[model samples]
Target: MSNLLSTPYLDRYTVNLTKKIAQNPDNYRAYEREPVTNRVLVSLLKKIQNSPLLVGEAGVGKTAIVEDLARQLLASNDKLLANKSIIQISLANLMQTSDGESFAYKFQQILNELMANKDTMIAFIDEIHQIVGTGADNQGSALDAGNIIKPALSRDDLQIIGATTTKEFHQYIAQDGALMRRFDLVEVPELSFNQTANILKKVSSQLGGEITVSQEVQDQIMTLSQRYITDRFFPEKAIMLLDGAISQAKLNQRLAVTTEDVADIIHADYHVPKYVINQTTDERLANLSQRIKERIIGQDHPLDKLTMKIINREAGLTDSSKPASFLFLGPTGVGKTETAKQLGILLFGEETNFIRFDMSEFKFASSSFERFKDKLTTEVRHTPYAVLLLDEIEKADPEVMDLLLQVLDDGRLTDAYGRVVNFKDLIIIMTTNSGAKAIQNHHAKSDYIKNDQKRQENFEEQLEIALQGDGYRPEFLARIGAMIIFDVLTLADIEKIVALKLKTLDEKAREQGFHIIFEPSEVLQYLPSFEYGYEYVEGQKVVSSSIAKYIADVGYRPSRGVRPIDDTIDVYIGDPVAQAIIAKRAGQLEDFNAFIFRALGNPPSLTSPYGEWQTVISRTKEGNYEVI
Candidate 1:
């Protein structure tokens, strides 16, 4: 404290850290007492190499460690840095205010000022990596800030302390071999959960108001901050979380910080809500299968397995760093993508939380990686707590698959700006049609699909051979929890799906001021039929419209699945009904009834009380389907 008054060199720098340490001595005591700070002090006080280079990740207290050294030198009467100014230099401010003074000239003057008081003064450079190429012209001169300081650093005349991130240390400092060896490196690690909790408690005490924090809240804050707040490190992020919670508690007129208060603050800061992390697995798992089945049809096998994995994830039994990744390998038009949408709504409470990437669009070799970088990382980063669907994985370029391997294994991807986008809270579902042919062949011959136990085994074996033959690497396949194979929709399954589709069609009809009913037929010949190969046409609307056309033009086949039934209904049933409503044909058709009329020789006509009515007479000059 007495030494600061004697040193006039501190006046040149904007901040006199030594004098500031005197004002609030306790503020710097915590860092001074830390073990890493002692190590840095030992390095800076060495006989030959007196400079200490502090290196660590951002927010890991590298600069704090250096400040501790300053505080200690001021408080104690140590000869090494005692009676020294310990003026901290901001490289940015130094260069900014050089005022036409040459970079070399400005740095030399500072070095001369410090060296003149050799044993009594020390210069601290924070973000010291900025020195490497401080003032280099296009001609590439080596007369930079680092080079200027190298001679002084090597001579042991100008005592200096440096702090920088590990990334910049290697990138900038390590490039200059001579300058690198001059300082002893001190690596500071991020504080552990317990250590961070201790620091938060100490901070709360020092503040001494209504900001009382319990050990449990601090522990939870540590865990939550580490998981959700990927961009920041421990102690720093934990402290921010705790302080923010304290501020929120004060604003609410609360006395102390509660877990709920901390959670609310964190939820506000990061969109990841507390309900997501602390979900009630008991109730969710109990109704998981039933909830999923309501949306998906004929995927009981895969759906059950997926539900179990989700239960395990929600139960906190699985790895938090890696998401519960699954590969939905099956034929087209199965409930693979639909299951993802349903799961998104189930887990995240909204279907909009489902983010999808159509791998078919990423087939081009040139733009595949760009698409992956642009959409995958950006979307996941924005909505970390959502379901990501990569549809039609087989159609994607191998580069896309290669890029996905890291995300599958680690649940993280470095974005273009070098930010790590977290996927631990995400449910990733990748659907592929790579093994559709083999799966079809297996079901065509074997009756083992009826047995759930043997069915999974047979499906697995066939898919393994199919995917391996298709050149999907085994390592990539191994990371996924399961490669769920969806069976081809059977006639019974399609009938159930048709019933479901009709319920939707009925709702739409009622919305438009009409009520259409499907007249019960013994064999549901009213719906469109799917042949063996062309069974997967995607939606019920297409199915109904196409089926209505098929029944009127071609007629239903016995082996047809439920594909395109909605299309048939829309074209023959919906279009005709809408036209009748517009034409005011209320007397002729008092009600709309859809049924299969297999009048072998009779033209496609609706047997009505008014007269014979063809379903599709012809397109009128006004471009309306003339149904009468």
Candidate 2:
């Protein structure tokens, strides 16, 4: 067996694994892949079906197992593998011609050589699925490489270890029954977190240079790889991250590899925010509510509930598999979508991490639902840690809801192509206007008062009833971590929002070398007031006869919440200021220092309804409109 017949064809197109290992013994250091390698060895020693098909995800160490088996055989006392050498058939070299006859003849010569030297040579084909139709003259040709080697494989005359991804194995080899039954299937699964960590440590020790990876850095590598690099399997991704960090450290002339090095690589490759990569989990979760509140105004109660659930989830008090999910029940334009956006910024350190899906677009049919699933799964696979906002969830089709139920329950979704996208790191938010009418009706009640806790509780109960009436299943609602009902915008909230809008306008004006300022108090005085009479004294509610100033009167309506304010600003301030800047740039108007928007005494007009004061934008403090 040690001195078999000459193998000219094998020598021409195959790589001698034993000779390669003998050349560099240090390169084949064993990790935790021994079990898989032993399985392959046992398959080769079998009296029947001596070939083994290595099935696993890409980068899950299928090829490595074969190489490790070769290394083990190089030092083993077993007679079966004493003189046997594992030779990998170079598919690239063997399939050098497209002509069916040429390739089939070449592959047959190689198979014949393997059969002649079966006692001393074992064959290994990486990506063995490629051989299925290799060198076929046409799509209907059956005389391909796979068919040519079937006789040898069926008789067990050649011990061939084939490796391919599970997807390819099913797509190609599993379809051919004759080719499928000849090889014993050895499944290789992904390594666990601790196993991957140990592999990284082993590889780090072998660096053996000025480049050194600390234990903490190795741990971070494993964690980040598992968390952010969802598209790839463990050990390989972690090792790649470790290698990249070490390469970066060496390139910068540094002796030690730090966490920053790992963070830099992950941030550059995955577009994960540098702050998110560098910050610890607790640091990322600190002051979450306060940070979100800075951007989302007048949603304190909802924000409080949302943040509490988030904190609890991050603290491991909730289901670890499922994502931190919430259903935002509210009227239009009441900071529902904005809250989701702010959460993305606060948690993931970037606003782009907020992914929004308008469920209205997915309401049509099963095809539309398929499209939604494709987009959702693809995006989450790419950016696992982000905020996913499904806008107007009620508008989505029932089929789409079925898909979401799976995600909400399992924290993972399998796409049509059988890839499971992880949602555990996502913040799932679904917003709906299902209870909007109920909210508006509750607020329209004459007894509605500011800071009325009991009224607020009653409003929530009404909203829940409304949601149930809107066809939401009980189990669907129950799976949501929290159902936060957004309160209607108040007069004070509108004033603050107006100030924010005006500030934005002023910044835009400044970009054109002009200054603009809006007197918030004077501006609020001119906006129309709502037809409700109410006031607050200390913590007590009081009834009044005077008109009440609510957000609705200023433009925040039930159908279009706060949108009129945006349009009003665009028309009155943004448009006028833009015109003024354009006129100045064209030398059509006199240069003005600043435009002040303030309310002043209006001329007597019986038809006017803006009270006794009118809002004006002028160039002076005397309330003159000369700039116009």
Candidate 3:
């Protein structure tokens, strides 16, 4: 090893590759990347242009190919490379001098040694882009490192192998036509999935201890890293995952590595939930519709369609590249956004996996569109398996809508920085009020309940016409998996929503050490029913009005959907209950265990309907009423 670096100038600023290979032979032997290694070797064998510039993305085995070439040279019968010694020149050490002249002198000495033994030595420079204009001065002498080496390279006096990333190669080396043309370019691409898995298997075998990785675990590492770890390329990312999982197993003093070990590493590094990483596809999506329905109150028709489309995509019955995209058409404050949230929770195991963008914020200008594109690409790149909800999408600028065409079509969008963000794992839901007035009009018809199927079909046709009038392109509509129409909430649905909200309120109260009970569990039913219009009888027909219309007439506004119900609960129930609890605490009512919420009126009967009702909250032991 010392003899290989025996030259004073070479020993001062370079590493001898042949010696490192001899010391740890297995590191260079396990997976040689034979195709790339042969490319580098064949280029090095050329007489006119013997140097090869290896350009690839990071972690794609550019440096490994060079090391493997050296290893092959040591045992080869090819006369050109058999006597060659590959030395890596360290640019950092060479540029340690004070000025350009001193640096140029040191580099010239290293070049002199290479020139004297040009037939027996080959130079390897990693991150070789740094060599271009490295030591250029304020004066116009082109005596920099790259310029000094060009003559020897062109004259075939020095055989060199240079490696750099694709970005750096274009940014720096490609600028100098004279220097760039001297070396043959060997473009190295990332390895395929099967290639990466084979490499992991070989590397795991080299572990050779009680700590073992099953073939199943290796397959998972490759698949998950390829899917979730999008910022990097394989087999490097896969190797890192394998190493981290093995380290985890060793820390726990376990003899065998499991899939959970790999999942934990992914969860920690990428923020993907452990359940998502650990579970199989079918397991994660098991009972998916039922799980969503548990949180979302109504809109079963749209939910059913959404569930089926997702299942179809997962089963490969549809285009698997793009996400399962949908346009949720309806009035605001319905279950559209809530359904998206529920899907996020049910599919990804948490609420944070739901990403939302209020498109109204991007409606003004091109600058806003750029901001939206940046944020959208970055978030999707980080969390590929999220439910992306674009609320009020009809309000966005035309440019922003244009941007989504590619995302819906290809399941990817390259950002301002030229990164292709993958949306294949996302569930894209866009909500709009473009046809809200039509839906509300249909719901208000006299026979809406009895003829719902026909009414819904008519409503959909009206909605497509309205969307087309609003300038929504036909191609965009065609790309969506479904344009699900969320219907106006019925009185029964609002009642269920109120109950769900009250359950949440009760949980909150219990968390603070007190319980809340809705007496009879139907005490809040009066909120959904109201009295307004007078009834009449005309010509043997009875004229009647519904509770839904009465509520709407009295400004309860059921047409606006569940938001009014939420506001009603917060004002009539939540605020009063909170105030009563505070007042009880102020009065030193610590012994009270529960608060009873009930209506202070006669329960409605056919003979005594239309009576006024008041909601009241009472502490159990205090027996004091807080009335509303």
Candidate 4:
């Protein structure tokens, strides 16, 4: 449709026209316009011409609907637009300060003139909610429109259209019973997705910008805005975006808005609420073969064949929506935690995709089942995918496995909170030291026996060496789609793990503006560290200070890696000697050696001084050290 430009000049209309100009189409603006499907609303407005008024959600298109109806009426009549026509009045704006004849007299005078030719004009009184305060001075407490507007309507000439945004419109224009019956109530829906997009487009055109958004961008905007932006008067916001885009483009001397420009515009509108979508999730099953080789190490065929079967069925290579859960019965430091994390990162796009639960904390299956059920549901709704980690499943009050029968069979569980968690969308990974060996060694040998009757009867003496251990029920163990046994880490594996852990810490430090590096990691990479380095004492895994203590003892390795001071094992105090010369030492062999030597001791971990504030550490050889 072409622009509606017939609205001519009127001294009194100057401000209204200016408002329209400000809101009209321009580049870098939100689109606004008459929607194509307002037919019912148009008829409602015409019917109100001889009657009362209608009010609804403030700032929604009540007035706009009336305006469009007026336009349509003029078009149909063909001469109404050119002749003595429709007039709208705001009583508050018209009341003069002069009290000689009273404001009511002036209001009545204007109304008298508006309906002078009663058979030809339509006057709409707006802001009708102001009726309560008007009658305080005594010429009575009401500006009853029934008597005032009846002159024209009785002769089939007096017609009025009243619009208001407050519920109290009924109080202001009191014609009561018969009068209130005359007007038809009409309502308008908030702008739809397409309407909002069009509004932005038109506003951009008005601003004289050539940029336009694609459907994809509009889709994203609508999806996000629906959840954040309140549905209200959007004209101001529309102009702000346009002005913002124009200002940004002028500053950069750019002719068109790129996607980056649009993002900046939107960011300005809402900064804190917009979340950044991190790494993308690549399907774990797709690359399960390779990850198993790297992370599980030595367990190739068992991992591959098992992973393939589970992956195929869930990937719709089968006809079911259900995903199977698996319990890995193996020794500690194997790859249970690492595998789950890897798969989460693989399937959900980040290494932290796994939601881990330490079974030691869950003494009863009922409570673990309850807490886990809520966390999983809420997390999945906000985040597309997750890997549920049941660390050391056997340690969880062995009866907890009793609860698993239902979950394993149906891939779901109803928690105490009454929330039904659907596990079909999740891939549950549980690790257990439940085999007949590990449990027997610990005092928890009785935890695995499924039978209450057989468990109490001389169970201690009756069990054979293998039967004495903690093993899961055959049916319970079978639910896991795949089982990758984690071998006790060889000393070599521990060394590799420690080295990797240190390397990760260094990277983190560098990102925080620390220039230190750990060269001693390679020196400590001897075999057997993985084999005997870590041990499960009671329920806790303890890897003494050799790696952790050495880092802590070193004290001041530029204060980059050794932050945690738990158990005096992981890290230690700072080296005063190294701290004094750290700012001075650079480039020489002694400088590097002195720094490494100082960081050999365990150091106490310090909390981030400011909860939210963080230091940014960028690294470059040229910037950090003159000698390196």
Best prediction by lDDT: 2
lDDT value, residue 210 of candidate 1 = 48
lDDT of 4 by residue, 1-628 (tens): 1322232321232123123323432311212434421443343335334344556555555565555544544434444323324567665554446545555565556555544544344556565545335534555655543444444444445455666655455554343554445554444445565676666555454564554444454444444454223323444344354556566766777775444554566545543112222211233355767865565443454467657766776556752444556666454445567677776665655554567778777676557655655554565433324667888776666556666666667765655555455555466788765452442343244446523545534442343223235565567655666665444433344434444554555564445444333343432232123244443335565442344334333322211222232222233212322342354455332332211211211223466321221111111233232222
Root-mean-square deviation of Cα positions for candidate 3 versus the true structure, in angstroms: 6.4
Give one digit per residue, the lDDT tens place, for model 1 in 519-552.
Answer: 3342233222422112122332212222322342
Better of 1 and 4 by lDDT: 1
Tell me the tens digit of each residue's lDDT in model 3 across 294-396.
7776787678888988888877798877888899988877789889888898888888899999998998875777888899999887777789999988888
Ranking by lDDT: 2, 3, 1, 4
Task: Single out the weakest 10-residue window by summed lDDT for candidate 4.
Answer: 610-619
Relative to the true structure, candidate 1 reaches a TM of: 0.78
| Residue 623, candidate 1: C-alpha displacement in angstroms | 39
Candidate 1 weakest lDDT stretch, 10 residues? 617-626
- Give the Cα lDDT of each candidate: 0.70, 0.79, 0.78, 0.47
The predictions' CA RMSDs to the true structure, in order, are: 8.4, 6.8, 6.4, 15.5
All candidates' TM-scores?
Answer: 0.78, 0.79, 0.81, 0.44
- Please report how far candidate 4 places residue 431 from its true position, in Å: 26
TM-score of 2: 0.79
